[model samples]
Target: MSLRTALIVLTVVSVTADTMILPFYPQFFAQAFDVHSQAHVGYYLAACCISVMLAFPVWAKIARRVHELPLWVITQTLAGLLGIACYFSQSLWQFWLLSQLMLCLKASYLMIYPYVLRLEERDKHLGMVGLFAVLMQLGGILGAVVGGALLEHYSARSLYLWMAASDGLQVLVCGYLMWRLRQGWQAPQSEQSTPTRGWTPHVIRLGLLAMVFYCAAFFIRPFFTPYWQSLNPDSALAAVSISGWLFSLPGWVALLGLWVNQKRPGSDDHAQVLLLAMLYGCVGLWLQASADSALLTIGRIIYAWALFQITVRLELWLFAHSEPQFYGQDFSKLHLMQNVGVILASMTVGHWVSAWGYASTFVVASVGLLLCALCLLWWRQSDSRNAQPSHS
Candidate 1:
């Protein structure tokens, strides 16, 4: 198989493993460890996030000195072991240490994204990025649906066993990619010719924008299942499955949005779309906060469209402003920034769900979207002169 196809397949398998237990985290917490405190869950999640945020930079620095293939082979092997350790965790603290370590190892998987870019021409960057988004979204849908059903029949810790298997599969795929390279298989040479440089102001702005916007967009994810269950008390037995599917609701909408985005004529409207998408997301959040199931579905659809657009365009903006030599390093920084948003969202949502309530999260998330808009406006003005729009 070609390197591109292998990497894309790896992305799907890895994402599915990572997100399988996500939608039912609350259930996992209660069932696995018999822990019920929302605040404790947040702290644990924050620790996991911190591990991932800090670990990627370490791996990036290592990749600078080491070839990516060997580095990934070593780390992913360790990550698979950690997954097995998670399955055997006897206490919350045991699970915490094991999972945090696993998350840090798995964080290196993120480098695959920018690496894939190096093998493609510059003009197709947005298309490739969008394809990754849609593919990951599909993986998420399958993971959540399968995980929710698994919850009905299996122990929550079984998810870790499946995750370990996925890691093993990733390692085998990585080997295939390395082997093909040795066999004289050649992909398109990237067109980026910019001199290697350190971080620029525009790149920093992009990082900040991603941080704030990602936190805003993902704030409602952790507790969404429980919230949905509360609204639909009738779904007693199939609650896990239904809620899991709902958790992937955004992914479904992302498929549609990206399909239309690709089909539609390309324009230099990335800046306008970036701004408008956030505003549209805010409207969607407001509708979700209405506390009606139908409106919630509609709101989710709207939010998904906006979220995926921002996600694709942000990377488009990053690569357009960044240098090829520093793709891994710059992307690591961006990864860290996005994780900061996730950590913030996780902690704050834990509090909001405990103190304020689930619906309040939507209102606060919309406020975040507005804040992101303001940041985007600032970034756009500063970057208007130096960078050309990245459109086909």
Candidate 2:
């Protein structure tokens, strides 16, 4: 396979592994550890998110010094090993420590974006980024379905083993790609430059946007399984399977959105797209907050469609604004902000769910989404005004 194909495949596999346990997290904690507290689940997830956030800049620094292929190979291997060890963890504390370490090593995959972008021409970046997004969504879909099946037919331990297996697959793929690239690959001239730019206004804006967007999106994640249980009230296995399918609904919707985007290409109205997405996102969150379970599915579909568009455009925006020479570090900084948003959401959403209830948290999340939309609109208008010619 070509390098691009390999990278895409690696991304799909890695993301699949990373997301497999997500839909069943609440169930896993409840069954395996007899822990049912949303707050504890949030704390555990927050630990992983914070670890990834801390590791992003460090990984970026290392990427600047080491070759991408070798770095990826080493990190993927270590992460896989750590994941396997995490599966054997006997206590929540032990699992948390190991999972945090695993994520820190796994965080190196963030560099893959800049690495892949470096391989393609500037004009192809958006298309490539969109392709990556589609693959990611597809991976999530597969992960959810398969993970649910595992949980139903086998055990939560089996799901962890599957996750470890995915990481192991990533390691093998990265190692092979490294060996192949070693034969003929040459570093780009831009790679030699010292990256000096740090936290430009554009970068800060993007970071702030990421922080808000993810904070809104992830607030409901840790409690989703429990929320589904409250709605469905089925047997454990049935609930796991049903919720998995429910989670996959968004992936299907996102795929449709991707198809729509493809049918009408060359429309670079990112601001407009983002505005529409956030509008839909707010509606979706509100629907989810409603007492009807059927509305929850509709809400997920709308939200997923919106999320798909926003993620593609956001990455494209970041790539367009970043300096080529500093792509790795710049992308890393973006990842840091995104993870910070997740960390904040995971840390605080539990308290909100614990106190006000899940429906109230969704209302707050909808408001947050609305704020992000308004902020983006303001930024776009300001940019347009600045670009106009001055009449003397």
Q: lDDT of all predictions, in order shown?
A: 0.81, 0.79
Estimate candidate 2's alpha-carbon lDDT, on a 0 to 1 scale: 0.79
Stretches > 4 Å off in candidate 1: 183-198, 232-242, 381-392
Query: What's each prediction's TM-score?
Result: 0.88, 0.88
Find the candidate with the highest lDDT and give its number: 1
Tens digits of lDDT, candidate 2, 241-319 = 6776775666677677667766667457767877898999899989888768878889878888878888888778888
**Candidate 1 structure quality by residue, lDDT tens digits, 1-392:** 77788888888888888989976677788988888877786777788789989999887766665656666777889999999999998987889889989999998888888878988988878788888889888988888777867877899889999899889988877777677676322222332333345667767787888888888877887777778888878756337767767677778887886777678744556778789999999999998887688898888888888888889888877887766667777888888899899888987887677788988888888999899898878767867754655531
- Could you tell me which residue pairs clash in candidate 1? none
**Model 1: ten consecutive residues of lowest lDDT:** 183-192
User: Stretches of candidate 2 above 4 Å error?
Assistant: 27-36, 90-92, 152-155, 158-160, 183-189, 225-242, 293-296, 384-392
Q: How accurate locally is residue 69 in candidate 1, as Cα lDDT from 0 to 100? A: 69
